[model samples]
Target: MAYKMPTQKYSGKILEVTVGSDLKLGGESVLPFYGFDGNIGNKPAIGMEIWDIFPESWPAAVLDVFKDAADDPLKWAAYCVEKYKPDFICIKFEGASPDGLNRSVEECAEIAKKLADNLTVPLVIAGCQDNDKNAKLFTKIAEALTNKNYAFLSAIEANYKEVAAAVGLAYGNIVVAESSVDLNLAKQLNILITQLGVKPDKMLMNPGCAAVGYGFEYVITTLDRIKLAALEQNDETLQMPIISPVSFEAWKVKESVVTQEDIPEWGPQEERGVAMEISSAVGVLAAGANAVILRHPRSVEVIRNFITEMTE
Candidate 1:
């Protein structure tokens, strides 16, 4: 007799959110990659992270991959789209942060509008890490490019009211409800965002993730808990798709940054950075990320292939 894999049925489905014209995420009625057990509507979408103003902190090895267009955001984004062909483009408005260059809302919005207007793929607009800055910037950008079906990287508990109201509800775009890696906090944040009229289908959850070996277990456990609740308990509030900004968290770790001279045992710098990104991205995809945003074209290519081999 042949051995058989056990199958399980889930009661609830993860609501699907569309980006650009056709990229779909979530709608899986089972845990990540359990296709034999239940319906998995779409393969996780992979987005490339482009910056409004490029950061100088990137590794030289990885930088070499994008050297031709690294200095200019528009060129960089177009280059990535033309070359890598990512599912979507995630624009990091780092210059607009209050602590950073403190770029004006209009300046950032103009750049954002230009990118949105030119990019053919769906755009994910991530504001600087400041709540106030993100609120103003998101609102400005949303107003400038309405109905293009863009997504925001986050609306935290602190500014859910402003973001959910202004961008999610008013502009009719998707909002990511971000919370620390805790089940209840994630659920509560989702509930709050939904209460503001941003329906589940128009929302994605960011239950927080970290690079591999850098508090990554918390990411997995949190994702598992959320998926269980959404599938087994049929928790509507927790049923939105999950989008992990893997690049933002992964590239900053020491493993990706230290030079081989600085740490000979760590091996090559660019290869290490790409490894870190791929590990973080694939780890989250297996754990539960419905979509992941990545840096480093090599990392994106590897994970894109992995997703195809598994999900397709």
Candidate 2:
């Protein structure tokens, strides 16, 4: 069978960032660089999320996956690493922030240290939603893990440059800069982080994620524009890699969490959750995301396999 393929051409190369001392988050050129005729130097890495506190509000399907280790962050992280074999672990300091559980900074650092020592793969430590609280949390962890060189700091937002600067000073390899859906805002935050002496290769930008049927189009457009600009050698903005919290979007969707009783004929909740993760991931890859923070070991396995097939 003969078919016509689009002969589109792209410019510039995807930037690569090595996470741990031995791990390489390699550069990839071409959207969803897994397909034939594209260039993908590194396999897209998977990161599983571990929270300090068990999320009681999570849907049954998700809660079941973490049932045994929900209350224990270290155990959960180890379990995910052992089971899913993820490339890294993203330890979410959900309740340890001032606006949340308000745990002491020392305690947060201790938890991060535990994960760092227990897991061999790279680590990502994220603070609670509050900017002030996260800044304080990341600062402490950044200092504690300075010598480790395997941990990536959660974020440095427009309002949190002080914390980001502290992290950069401590030699953290990666820091996430988040902005609303605005591309300019995303670029501006990246610039702010770089101004703090952090190199372009060490920064990751997340424009925030929206669930399917809930502003997903806007998220896609934002990511597409950002990638397009980067391909054109928009040096200031295209120099860093892009990350997306794909699981966050899927877990929050009603179809992913609601029971059949709440919405009959929705099929199995677990299957729906997996589907949501896959759809969001595929879309984000098309938009030029280099990495993703995901949950559910099953979904990670599926997505990794899919990426492998595409790259082959």
Q: Which candidate is the best by lDDT?
A: 1
Top TM-score prediction, candidate number: 1
lDDT of each: 0.88, 0.75
lDDT for each residue of candidate 2 in 59-102, tens digit (9 for 90 to 100): 77788887788889888988888878888888888777565678
Report the alpha-carbon TM-score of model 1 versus the true structure: 0.97
- TM-score for predicted model 2 compared with the true structure: 0.90
Report the lDDT tens digits of candidate 1 across residue range 198-270: 8888888899989999999999999988998999999988888999999998899998899999999989988
TM-score versus the correct structure, for each prediction: 0.97, 0.90
What C-alpha root-mean-square deviation, in Å, does candidate 2 show against the real structure?
2.7
State how far residue 119 of model 1 sits from its true place (Å).
1.3
